[model samples]
Target: MSEVRTIGILGGGQLGRMLSVAASRLGLRCHIYEPGANPPAAEVAHACTTASYEDEAALRAFARSVDVITYEFENIPTSALDLLEDLRPIRPGREALRVSQDRLTEKSFLRDLGLATAPFADVTDAASMTVALDGIGTPAILKTRRLGYDGKGQARLSTPADAEAARAAMNGAPAILEGFVDFSREISVIAARNADGDVACFDPGENLHDNGILRRTTVPAGIPGPMRMDAVLIASKILNALDYVGVLGVELFVTPGGLVVNEIAPRVHNSGHWTQNGCVVDQFEQHIRAVAGWPLGDGARHADVVMENLIGEDMERVPELARRPDTALHLYGKAETRAGRKMGHANIVTAKSS
Candidate 1:
């Protein structure tokens, strides 16, 4: 394979910004293609193409500028990908996106792999929802199959009678009804794979969420050693199944029965943010290495860390947080701060455990 000197990124969010930073560290340039002006990544990337995905000329130009293409998020329009995929390699591949972009498809894929997930059924309308509720029961979550994140595009059904309101919440989008799973806590494994089929998984991190947005992730998750292994194996399993390259984040629920699959992100994950301060190679760098055809780096944890997300009003605590020792703050260069917006994060190293 030819040497890769440039990477083309699909989205220009914080993940893209961090990926670009990591790429630069490795003597690589990143070109960010985003429709939104003043994206966070524009400040860090070597170049930014401000054009809609529908713009074929911009897409072709952007494709010609980079050696490999990767994305910060799923949900890139298929038409855009069809054009770009013909010009350059898209790491993690389209299958990963096809499997992860829809809730129902993701759940079904997990089940087919002999993995455990919450009982889920498809719901397109009132009729299908009634059947889904009948099987999944009440106290369930009705979520749109596509384009939902950070608690958006979801509604909770406390009881069967609340089905109407929950259905209405879907706004006519195809939905899935998931029966609640009894889990002790949420954890995630940030795993990476390269074209050579080698896989490396970081230590699992325990997560805490507020209003569907991740609030904190603590490394050295207070789980048994074996459970941690289980998380890693699960991540590795998915990585291999997809013939995946680059980094993938797998979220799981530690249930009394076993760890249950939650969802997968095909790029560097938020839960792995602590690695920035706690590991020799962070998720962003690992992803760049994998996609750039470099060997994977050691992701072994060298410290105990607590990563906290700075959302909206949390930005007010930045000055106080900066005063604390052993804390590293990574603020996204977002222009505006609004309710539920993720402004930045802090990784607090509690101890050097390695």
Candidate 2:
């Protein structure tokens, strides 16, 4: 059993901030390691190390200071991870990072597990891009295999003629062409697993994306009973396959054919914010519990919730949002908000009405 008093989080983003708050509830301290100065997590964390991932000395100190290490984001530098893993245990493990760091690898991993995914092919250059387009055809998305999120590093090709522009958008990076899925809506399952191999999954939340960024997620997804079961089962399968410890977010396409896996996030996800108001144990606490070697918590939902993200100028509505009843406002301590920046989120519970 692990006696984790201080948890080390790799990224100091909003997720890290929430994790720190959750750890506090469990009487655990969190140390955040981030390259950026004065990151949001620093406001809540017990300790904050502001240094680049390439700095071995800083990495050594950060790893040695904490009982166990976990990360908010998957794109950590490999060298930094190697140093930290040798000094302390990193939960969710390196294999999860290895698979999720690259979209091509993630898709292949899911495919090998006999799970459904959109058809995808790798593209290295113009020649490969042409070949991939020939196979997957147009009306596909060209995305960088690594380092892409929230609508960045992605291009849409409506016809074969648009391949050149899409390829140019890649900026010479290795890319993947993915055939789109015919889905009615998207949903995500926030799943958790502890070191003991027990798994718990929250009710799948129906997701709505705007400009490729998640705008809102509503609980009691408009899917049928069996699909909900399938969503949970898929999440359990992934947690077990990776031997993952901590919360994982599994995004799926609710298609008429069945549920199709879209992607997986190793850390707590934006869609799971509804759990803050809807469940007894939210994703952040579940993550802290897993990495600290505690038993997984019950994730059953007690109320219907709709979580809406406060992006960029959305901060203007915080006052109005806070004034309403049954609304929980979670704001990240960001000094400035640029366009498309995630300022915070609001979890609004719907009251049962006659």
Candidate 3:
């Protein structure tokens, strides 16, 4: 802990950018190791190593340059983890990564822990998908096991007739078929764990998505008073299960029976961005503290915040939102404005949203 002056981050995206900023605030330097050039994180990081994850020589150099390593996203190449971890510690650990990398494995882990989740089946081909649908029933979602995010690599099945389309979506990749859950709202709990085994969880925030991309996250999720405690407890159970150290985002479906686990993100999540303006310590800083072996900070909220993402062309609205009261804008600094890409976000703070 005392020797942690530099941190190495995998993937140089917006999450990495925020992490780098947080590390700087703590007087720690960040070194980004990403394959892409001019990554957002590289703008704020002290150094950047643009190289492929498969390049062991490059990974070895990155490992030697930093005291500890962490990642911005979950789809990291296992070979990189195997190589870098031998030189430095990777926080949140490999177990968390392994479980969250695949939808089937993640669901199984949750179910095994006695947590509630949607009925699911593994899909490898057209025949397998057909078999999975028979048991999971119609109105299901077919999603790839890896490298899928923000509505990519997924197709919805309304009935047996939709099987071909669902299978086609996989395009030969391994997939999972999940039964749908009729829920009132979707909420995510961002929790953190330190090396000392101390855990701190943020309040649940309700989410709204458009075409699989998160559009907004509203705090005080309107969860029934009693359900709030249960939500936090459920997220804590997952953190302890993996012996996880660093922040984990647990996405849950609010149902009448109880909360149904939807997915788990192994790093700082988009939904947790509201914490930037609402909480004493945001998810980004909490993650940095945990991985750096520092004490976690208070995650309590001082104001109700609604975080709205600027997807693609939404950047046009920034000029207007900038003049709005109590709004904090955080842009990703991406050069291209591809449709559905998260270019930035604006957090609207107040007593609460009506």
Candidate 4:
């Protein structure tokens, strides 16, 4: 394990909290850097630096104290990472972060690698939106270039009349219009790549969304064998392309033609949370292994599992889910439950006959 004992995480949300817990199991420690107080990760981490990303002195101190660094989310400011890169090794690296930070850049990077993504064009204003609409047509999605997630900063344009208002809503942020894909289901592959160029992928999990937030993810994806293999291969290609180290979530649209890349997340992801109880090694531990420069674990599923997100008011049902023998409940220590916020998740595992 190279005797690397401490990991520094860039975000202090639930992902970092779970990662810290996983690190502890492997005899390692975690230090979280986040701007907010009482972050979930801070509760379990060995240390925490509550400083804004713009605070260079705090960032420098955080870098000097850790052996390696990784981020829980992709929205981390590039400038902060640029400073930290000079002081410590950051897993999954800047290239992966750069690719994932912008929707247009991410799509273009995938296209350059000869991967399939929905047709898209950069739209900065009404003029570009008009041009992009001409090529991609209506019934498209216009998403902001940065800081968007869980259905935020995105609008659907079903007809030409809706295009102007959609552009106005974004307030002139750099955006992209993506031609919608007619797909049967949304699936994601959780893959991990180590420093030594070894890659391992968990089973592709089929996903369902409620109001654009991931509602449920079930393994076996109910797809044909070839289709499942295709999803795995696509995830592997993305990890290899970025020379990534850590878990990567590749969201795909399973269309009649084949799997199409929707986006990539360069950290432990929600869809793979079921691995905590369903697999020999969960995505969080795999991420800890990758960032720590250790050998990756067996990415084998031990049970048929379904992961359901506890969104907003869903947290009220914790008592009910906890009563079920087959369900494992995880509640994030968030004080407020705003609409659409991801509060926690529950994993239901069932043994499968060989």
- Each prediction's total of clashing residue pairs, residues at least 3 apart in sequence or on different chains, is 0, 0, 0, 0
In terms of lDDT, the poorest run of 10 residues in model 3 is: 345-354
Candidate 4 lDDT by residue in tens digits, 1-354: 477899999999999999999999899999999999999999999999999999999999999999999999999888898899999999989999999999999999999988889999999878888999999997999999999998899999999889988888798798999999998999999999999999999998999998779999998688888988898888989899999999999999988888889999989999999899888889999999999999999898889899999999999889999999999998889999988888999999899522
Scored by lDDT, model 2 comes in at: 0.94
Which stretches in model 2 have alpha-carbon errors above 4 Å?
351-354
Output the worst ten-in-a-row residue range by lDDT, candidate 4: 345-354
* lDDT of every model, 2 decimals: 0.94, 0.94, 0.92, 0.93
lDDT tens per residue, model 3, 42-117:
9999999999988999999999999999999999999889988789999989999999999989999999999999
What local lDDT does model 1 show for residue 227? 95
lDDT of 2 by residue, 188-301 (tens): 999999998999999999999998999999998999899999999999999999999999999999998999999999999999999989888999999999999988889988
Given candidate 3, what's the lDDT at residue 234?
92
Residue 71 lDDT, candidate 2, scale 0-100 = 92
Question: What would the TM-scores of all predictions be?
Answer: 0.98, 0.98, 0.97, 0.98
Which scores higher on lDDT, 2 or 4?
A: 2
lDDT value for candidate 1?
0.94
Clashing pairs in model 4, backbone N/Cα/C closer than 3 A = none
Residue pairs with backbone overlap in model 1:
none
RMSD of 3: 1.4
